[model samples]
Target: MKRDKDALTLTRRIGVFGGTFDPIHIGHLVAAQNAMHAAALDQVLFVVANQPWQKEGTREVTDPKLRLLVVSQVLRTIPGLEPSDIEIQRGGLSYSIDTLNELRASHPNDELFLVVGADAASQMPTWERAEELSTLARLVIVNRYGYPTISSILDFDQPILAEMPWLDISSTDLRERVRDHRPLQFLLPETAIEAIELYQLYRNRENG
Candidate 1:
């Protein structure tokens, strides 16, 4: 299988972990770490979506600049994690295939793995240009708690299943916590919390 091909001479093994990341939380960090370690990725890029298509028309999303700022602030303290604004720079709806294509052109010799949650992987067939997306990079399906069971029928290249400890946290809840002036002490990184406060984000908006 193409996904299983030995990368004996690859310059880098980069994992693309794309998300709306309206607010990047601890769980998001944990999942990225687990995937990188399990898949032996050299670096994991936290690709912030400019406008998440699925999330569009759903609720108000934090500004991309603020979201990217928080991500950069938090990731700066961590090694092996990188903040990318490729999708944000592209502007408009952020699609996985488009991101991968840009990455492919930029890192021609690197092995690219598209890191996604198991729940998201199950819906791979419905993504924009699904068939072509499958060929752009190998898949790393991060499994957590096994609640939303992924069907055994997803046809993607060299799908690697990476298990992650389930964290009972969500961006929605985090946003609410901020809005209510509740303690976010242990929920988000201090840097992220500081950045949020510095920008006065989510202080006046209701969760969508």
Candidate 2:
């Protein structure tokens, strides 16, 4: 029997770039864009964490809705980058395996690429259902300039490496800068900065 060409489902390559995104910064955006290009991803979804289990007791996390809002606003004008509230909607400790499971269920035919930083890649073994990540999606590790690709062994296939110049930016630093009312010029997208200002987010640790 001959199958119709129109009946064939084209497999799309989707990159899942999950993060706390307390306030999406330029580093995060650059990593995702470079990862997408390096991995040949069709699109990248910025999955905002509802509650990052690892950071639960360490410090305060910005509200998930507010974080998602920042992500959406900044990604609005960027092509092939999207904001996903999957973890936020699920309402629990955000786990990569859980998110990948949900994405797999919804997108069975598509190829999934999980993007992570070099630092995070070294700790994959400690993640929940860590061994199952290989079965769920291919890993794409983003390494900053001058940083060597990690040699840690894992069960998954060799990760695709995306290299970019190092940017000295962190969510913690951004939050503190906002708290101190310091200028954030060139650190984050204007849209994200605007959203942060509009929501009066991170004005203080107590309310952040």
Candidate 3:
């Protein structure tokens, strides 16, 4: 895809994949790659949430820096995957509409694509400024295993729902496996798993 070059050259087709990435895993990578290909995006930015408003009672993420590190490590192998600190730098409850708006402002001529899971797409209407968000960017909802039907989401008007390779993996399951001292060899990329082990995340640690 050719980027639009004006006074300042700007990549016109960019995909924004926002997630908590408590521990970046293969599932996240697969979805992003699939969305990029399906949407013909020039680049995909992985926006790690600084504060996920949706996961309110889900225990404040282990550590944002650690999560960012894991994301960086996982994205290292992917050519077009770019790790962005936009949400983290903003420092507040991360909202999709706000992030998309910020990105749109940064690249005035570019077409923004917001990548999301089918489950998220199903409940998008309830999110803050859902209508405005829909207008700001084209939503690319990746169909995950066991996701609800797309028709249920009234907010997504003529949204792009792409069928990607299904990988039954999730951060929640990964965290549980870690907490239980179970093996997580194949759940995530080797680098991501190594980073988790190095940081001793999820494992009960003594602190003074």
Candidate 4:
């Protein structure tokens, strides 16, 4: 019974977790660790977006190169997690399909999984090359509060819902705290905190 239960817990071999990671925080770390343990994934690559289409021309986004550096520092303390700069190197609107295609070519033998939140999964139908995304990776939607569980919308294939821990942390809030000069001793990793201080990130809300 124990062996069977353990076997059932194992999930994917490799998971692709792409995001802005503007300020990688404890909440994001918790989500990734939760996904890895619950799904039994061997490893997860945190891919920081270079030119997030949604952010460009509408919102102020942090420098992609700096974001990548911060993500690497944070992931160093956490095992089974690695940072990928594929999109940063590509230098354009980061598309899910393009990243997945690259991963498939690099690791043809490994079973690939794409990590997503309920919101991103819901917007799949409208994503760039949306039709081809499902073919490249198996989607694993992370559990986030307030958002109802969504399967498939607009004829898109349903993503597998993953059970995760609740963490009330957001980059928006973190930035606000920084702008207000609030303490962030426990909300983020020391490396992330150090990087933010070293580069003076989020000091001025107008620029962050």
Put down candidate 1 lDDT per residue, 42-139, tens digits, no spaces: 89999999999888899988889889999999999799999999998999999999999999998877889999988788777778887887667888
Show the colliding residue pairs in model 4: 11-39
Candidate 3 colliding pairs: none
What's the distance in Å from true for residue 65, model 3? 1.5
lDDT value, residue 147 of candidate 3: 58
lDDT for predicted candidate 4 compared with the true structure = 0.81
Give the distance in Å from residue 6's predicted Cα in candidate 4 to where it truly belongs.
Answer: 26
Model 3: per-residue lDDT, tens digit, 1-208? 5545554555568999998988888788889888888888889999998888988775757667778888998888789999988999998888988899999988878889888888888778888888788678887888865655463355546667777766888787888888888889878899988898898887883211
Q: Report lDDT (Cα) of residue 84, candidate 1.
A: 98
lDDT of 4 by residue, 92-164 (tens): 8999889999989887666787888777777778888787877887777787756687765443356666756
How far out, in Å, is residue 156 in model 2? 1.4
C-alpha lDDT (0 to 100) for residue 68 of candidate 1:
94
- When 1 and 2 are scored with lDDT, the better candidate is 2
Worst ten in a row by lDDT for model 1? 1-10
TM values, all candidates? 0.92, 0.94, 0.89, 0.87
Minimal lDDT window, size 10, model 4? 1-10
Name the candidate that leads on lDDT: 2
The backbone clash count of each candidate, in order, is 0, 0, 0, 1
